[model samples]
Target: MTSKNRDLRHLHEFDAERLITLGRAVIETETAAIAALAPRIDAEFARACRFLLNCQGRTVVLGMGKSGHIGGKIAATLASTGTPAFFVHPGEASHGDLGMITPDDVVLALSNSGETDEIVALLPVIKRLGVPLIAMTGKPRSTLAQAADVSLDISVDKEACPLGLAPTSSTTATLAMGDAVAIALLEAREFSAEDFALSHPGGTLGRRLLLHVSNIMHTGDEMPVVTETTTLREALLEMTRKGLGTTAVVDADNRVAGVFTDGDLRRTLDAGIDVRSAPIAEVMTRQCKTTRAEALAVEALSLMEDHKINALLVVDDQQKLIGVLNMHDLLRSGVV
Candidate 1:
């Protein structure tokens, strides 16, 4: 083939090569940016964390376009991890959303050039509220950076875009920096999962970390109960009906006096105990490990782990069986 013909015919290959080059360049740039962040962890970062930590009101995150997308994610991460935060579109902030900001709140603004007009336009109003401004910007000398109480530099050497127009490396660096700030603040505050559940009770983490034994345990009439005078056959029927693999034996007062499990049944049978003639109390476990209904699932996990058991009888203060929890429940709920 002729030289011009070869060039035109192989254009697709050239384009593919160019795309690979850009992708690698972006990855390498972001890797260098994240690495450089180690040296940039200074007192300003500490000040930012302290500012956000001491903030009595919400954290309002602001940015435009690509930065706005990243800002939204940062806000979500902050809100989930213990910081009370939400994202506000810079454009909307000027029109009416500015009311969301309070004097006690803090602003985390993101901008690659540090001169996004929409975000910059809200700076004065944020200042008027006496709220602290923490800026994440690539240009440290830009107006937003200069006005910030703490400036995080997220500069990148070049964009992966051949024309240097698309926000590739700079946005990546900015996102990493935002996460760094949020996580540092989170750890410094010693935020607990219980605290996090307060912010995200509707999600899976909330269900795992926040849901207690009481919330999901089989309670009331669903509980498997057998009196001390109940026959072994009667106790077995109750266990089968409850589908909990165990039964709680009660006294005249309906207190949980003992527990009988399939394991105990096996041992009793191995000892040649006549189930037809014997009472259920003959094979029941007196003083069984019981948990309060309100106990956290995580606490239940600890209990199961320490006892090497798969189930627990949940009881109230009076030792009346109120509910039951098993390993399967914890596993399904992701508490274990």
Candidate 2:
């Protein structure tokens, strides 16, 4: 058998109950580790947040091994959450990428043992340049912590690994601590949702926040509109021409008076109304739902859901007809 098949057979030796126990043990261990970190967000954690907040230059994250992987994610989270930050591998730092560090920048070094040679080697230079150092280490007394201006301890009671050799619980704790720091800074800055959306312009939140009704609403001739004195047949023709499933009926001032929809047509026919000869105002539903052209498309969506509607007429402050938007418009614009 191939090596992969042999590995699969070995994995099959452990039944469902054994697998569940193993998975649960790891989850419980990590859960406890994260829970323990709550109490440790003490004065030192506040100090770390203050340092990052005051940083005029970007926060440079440094790490080695598994800590490096976690540090990269921490840097990304910080950058995306209004704190400008980036990651630099310690091994690469020793090999001349150290030039990326500037006096204006703050260094956040990560090491579970706090004694990784490459990270430790950069300490003297970091100090020489007067760069503030924030160390996240399991060992508070180790070299990295001693060299830092602010040391936020990420100590864990035990590893989730069965052998207690792999970095599991400790890494999870460090990641949680990093998130806590980034979020604290984000709140301190009072970072607005618009500011956050600016940073994530390609994300779903950006689409929802940046896209306004004016950008997607059907305007001018594309909007289905008719006068209240118009015949029901003419309104139906207008609805068919615009293909919006509905048409707005306007009064003498050209402002919306009511709406004539497919549902109105059905009820009108059942009541034996002569659609070809009856005025639209006689059978249309008055006080129809409407939206402003300046509103967000997401707000329009909420209006649709709250009122169980699929479309809305866009109006101005004076209640004058301006445009029309439907669920299809939102979907087409990637706002839904």
Candidate 3:
């Protein structure tokens, strides 16, 4: 092996218990820091939420370095939870990005020292714009905190970093505090799941909540259907042609009367019935589960699961067959 490989293998030879102990210590230290922040969610935290909730415009989040990473996540959480927010690097703000901020906007600044040079430099401009300022910092008496309309304390007892240089507990505490503020505003605004789905239309939850039965159900000639008086043989042919393993049995008025499926055929053969001359109505399941085209696709999935069926027919208010859907359709549409 090469010298470098030998060195890497030697490094790996360190006691495994030592590595685990170190990892656990970091987690425990960060956990304590987050726990300490819970009690600090006082009147000031409420005032911060109020400011963000009442803002007529977006919340412009500003931070530097490690705090900037945390701020971006906080901004995303806020935006997805009903608050309009976005992150702007403090350094970029000094280079004309400050134009993005408006008098109607609220500024949330984060800096562990409360004196990040870039953010501190933008204070005069923000003040001149008459925008409300909310500062999140470890130092409550620092310049950024003193200039803010409300200051949030994100202080940690110590760094999880053994050398006390890297951001560990401080960043974790900041993130937790940001979530507390975002969730508090979410509850205050009574944000619902539907509202959240609108912001995440491409995610799984959005597919489940926003997609309706009409969007994925087979309609027109694609639907497998037969008249109530159709021969059992003809219903089986229709099921094969549509590949849905089931066929809707409708009355003379095109109203859904019952459903015939592959399972019914098996039962018929087992009972020694003749498929060539038997009527579909005799073997079709009466009062089969059905859904409306306008209902959510997830609701249809619920019905199929609850009734232990694999397919459902869509009907109108008058119980007329409009469309047909099977478990395969839901699986293809990501509703399953």
Most accurate candidate by lDDT: 3
The per-prediction tally of clashing pairs is: 0, 0, 0
Candidate 1 on 301-329: residue-level lDDT in tens?
Answer: 89989987777889888987788888888
TM-score-better candidate, 1 vs 2:
2
The residue pairs found clashing in candidate 2 are: none
- The models' CA-based lDDT, in order, is 0.87, 0.93, 0.95
Better of 1 and 3 by lDDT: 3
Tens digits of per-residue lDDT, candidate 3, 104-158, equal: 8999999999999999999999999999999999999999999999999999999
Ranking by lDDT: 3, 2, 1
Highest-scoring model, TM-score:
3
lDDT of 3: 0.95
TM-score of predicted structure 2: 0.95
Better of 2 and 3 by lDDT: 3
